[model samples]
Target: MHGLPQAEPTNATIRPGAAARRSPGWRISRRVRIGLASLIGTFALWWLLTDITGVIGPHRFPAPAEFWAAFVQIAIDGYAGGTLITQAWYSTRLVIMGFLVAIATGVPLGLLMGVSHRAEALLNPAFLLVRPIPPLAWIPLAIVWLGLGDAAKILVIWFAAFVPSVINTWTGVRGVDRTLIAAARVHGAGELRLLWEVIIPGSLPMMFTGLRLSLQASWTTLVAAELVGAFFGLGRVLDAAYRDINPPMIAVAMLAVGVLGALTTRLVAVAERRLIPWRS
Candidate 1:
């Protein structure tokens, strides 16, 4: 009996390559390869349609070379008296301002509503009414109230972001485990302790989800807000390009919006990883 070899765990035999599959680096590398392939394939199709076939006219859609030329021109020579960098920064700044304000205001109010039935009853109906309204709808009122300034732009962006933040946060808090709440209560945890230890930690993932959504909303609304009266922003760049019938410049501006949005989303992802490392 002492000389007999010990049996290998049954689980080990069933999970071949499981460790490799579970490796974080392996997963990340796989995702990177897939994403790169997708981008390359898209660009190849675009190039084929525009440059090779010429089925799509330059006036309708700029070729890759034209797009590159337009990008370089805006990056160096400037457009409407502002370089692309400055214009993109203007839009990004508005997004940041509005996003931060939404987070600051929405999270606390959401927490209140989540914990208090009375508060929820009082606020939920109003939020429901406002949630269906489009951010673009706020543009006319914003111009009237705040004029053609950054304030008007920020207001529009703020409204776009605020609803998602509050809704997601509220939903997150409400989604916290009732069993955990009961256990905490049984253990004589006070309401504040229950909130801090049991609720907030549990709800953080959803809260961060809300933040990401809010940031996206901010970027999307920034473009529309700037379209109305901004002197310097990607949206204004787009407007000018349209008025001049310059497809290349329009393509450049649209690309800038997409790139900037992606960059900001990356920033939010980094923050999410830092704040919620367990989930990451």
Candidate 2:
């Protein structure tokens, strides 16, 4: 008994596969589960309300089934000789052009405003006044000046997008840490070097935020422009459906618009992630 080793407590032993068992399942967090459940519940409620209670007539407010049927038909047969696919392409192209224009002009102007006090003083009041005007309010002038063509639509979309982008980009650059700029100067960094290496990188997150806002604004304006007068686009299809008093078609068009907008939003988010990887 004097030389014998004492036994270790069995309860203190670590199980070989215990960690494996305790590993998270699908890593599904509570928030994600709740969000998914909420979406499903919303769809279920919508289906029940529209299908069961004929509270609104089919012509006025069609059922979900009716809208789905119309969507399928449009997908297969096309809308007014052009399929939803074609209309979507047309709308997408217009949005891209307008967005590109806004980016090209807005970024440089925003940088100027952020960098130079004189430029900011000269332009800030003009931007404040112009930004407040609704894109829809510009419709009549766009039509008169650019005609009821692609130009009018593109201009409207550009106007809707430009303000947010410029404002956000300007804010981002202006908000850069002053101490960082001072440090850069103390290290013998020139104005160009400081801007290119430090300021631009620091301002990128805010610029991306502005770009996201601009994309949404542009998309909304595109629809409004198309609704006013256009031969092709999702908005035009909706307009035609309205004229025909076809609630089902209208609902289908609405769904298409929602889907497209969501897709664009996701695209912007992806771009933001890639461009601003420093952001959490």
Candidate 3:
């Protein structure tokens, strides 16, 4: 055994992270568990306050049974000659139309402004002038121009969505690394190629941020947008409920709006993940 060299340890002999690989781990995360518990506790508290103690009356806040009854009434008996589904569809349709229009125009304009100083100089003044005005302010002009129809509502919603999209996109594009752009130029990449390959990719994260904001803006503006001419929408339902002094109906409509906003925002997140797979 004198002067004999020892054999090197093989991977088969030493397995790092073997325990980690074997462990099933917690299937449900702590955050998720806490969230579930919080929701359950909140509902329990609401039940206690409303049903058990009667401290909160149905006039102020509907009990679970009252809420359910209102939901059924709207679902079955309908509201303003349109069922809940019909109203929801109308609102969703308006949102989609306005949202699409906003992105279609806003993205290109933002990109152009970001890429060319001349474009920014020419447009920035007007953009700045108009951007500060709230979307609600446009309602009167929309009514005068497009009349009391879907177009007017869409216009208002478009304004709501457009500002953030442009601002965010422009910021995103401008924020792209100058070094990368210069490197791309050194590699003989033309303006178009540089924009497509580098600029868009670099800017996508902020662009998506803009998109999410735009989506929220669309939903937030929906109720106001529908105020003028909409005969059937969640906004209309809320308005009608308020007019009729029906607290349960108002709660149901508000819940519907909240649910729809959440669903749409989720869709945008899904799209962002699909398009920007590299983002964590």
Candidate 4:
């Protein structure tokens, strides 16, 4: 007994279970509930103002019920002999292609500019001059160069998405802590190794921020691009509805665009959360 070791109590080990895992879902549901409530309240106010007060005539600002009915009809019957699904698919494809092009060019260019003063000096002025020009302004040039097809739409979206990504990536790379670079060098890390390991990891958060902004810009520009001189997109559907003075159809198109944009933004947010898990 004098030489024996004493046994220790384990206490009640309280490890998290499935219930704890479910808490995130509950939190998400609570937030969704709040959002839905707010949307419902806002729509109620809109309906009351339009229907009861008659501040804006029903002919001009059609009743919310009418819009809802129209939206349902369009969803069921499709638009301009083409399904809403078709138009949405076309727009989504163009956006994705354009976004990919932007990232391919912008990220490398940004990294070059960030790492090399000469590259920045050579390219920055041109980018600054070009960036201020709106995507709509490029529509004429895009049409001239690529014509009234998928190519033109994709080009317009690329222009819209590229600038923010390049600027943000450049900023991120430039902002990497100098001490990390020195330490990497001290450890005999080669330029490529340092860049891949130290610089990229450090700069990833800002790059993701840029990516999110680029996606938003791409979504906004897609409608404008389709409206200018093209067919088979949500924007084109909206344009046709406007021309026909079909307010309900117009509302449906608008709602579709808003939902798609919100969904894209949320997807990007999810990616950001997963990729940058260290961030609060």
Sequence-dependent TM-score of model 3: 0.88
Which pairs of residues collide in model 1?
A: none
Compared with the true structure, what per-residue lDDT tens digits does model 1 show for residues 1-280?
2463333456346764664464456555656878999999999999999999998999899999999998999999999769999998888888899899889999998899999999999998998899899988999999999988899888898899998889888999999999999999999999899999989888889998999999889988888877777778999999898889999999999988999889999998888888777774
**What are the clashing pairs of model 3?**
none
Write one digit per residue (lDDT tens) for candidate 4, span 47-161: 8888878887766767888887777676688786577788887888888888889988888888889999999999989988888888678889999998889998888888989
> For model 1, what is the alpha-carbon lDDT of residue 85?
90
Q: Which 10-residue window of candidate 2 scores lowest in summed lDDT?
A: 4-13
- Against the true structure, what is each candidate's TM-score? 0.87, 0.86, 0.88, 0.86
Q: Candidate 2 regions off by >4 Å?
A: 1-32
**Residue pairs in candidate 4 whose N, alpha carbon or C atoms collide under 3 angstroms:** none
| True-vs-predicted CA distance for residue 271, candidate 4, Å | 1.5
lDDT of each: 0.88, 0.85, 0.87, 0.83
- Cα lDDT tens digits, model 3, 127-161, are 98998899888888988998877888888889999
Q: In model 1, where do residues sit more than 4 Å from their true spots?
A: 1-28
Worst 10 residues of 3 by lDDT: 4-13
Error of 2 at 163 (Å): 0.6
Name the regions of candidate 4 deviating beyond 4 angstroms: 1-30
Ranking by lDDT: 1, 3, 2, 4
True-vs-predicted CA distance for residue 73, candidate 4, Å: 2.4
Task: Highest lDDT: give the candidate number.
Answer: 1
Candidate 2 scores a C-alpha RMSD against the true structure in Å of: 7.6
- Residues 1-280 of candidate 2: C-alpha lDDT, one tens digit per residue: 2363333345225543544443477346768978999999977777777787766668677787888888888899987557889988888889989988988888889998999999999999888888779978998899999887899998998898888888888999999999999999999999999999888888998998888888888889988998988889988988999888888888888878888888988998898888777778
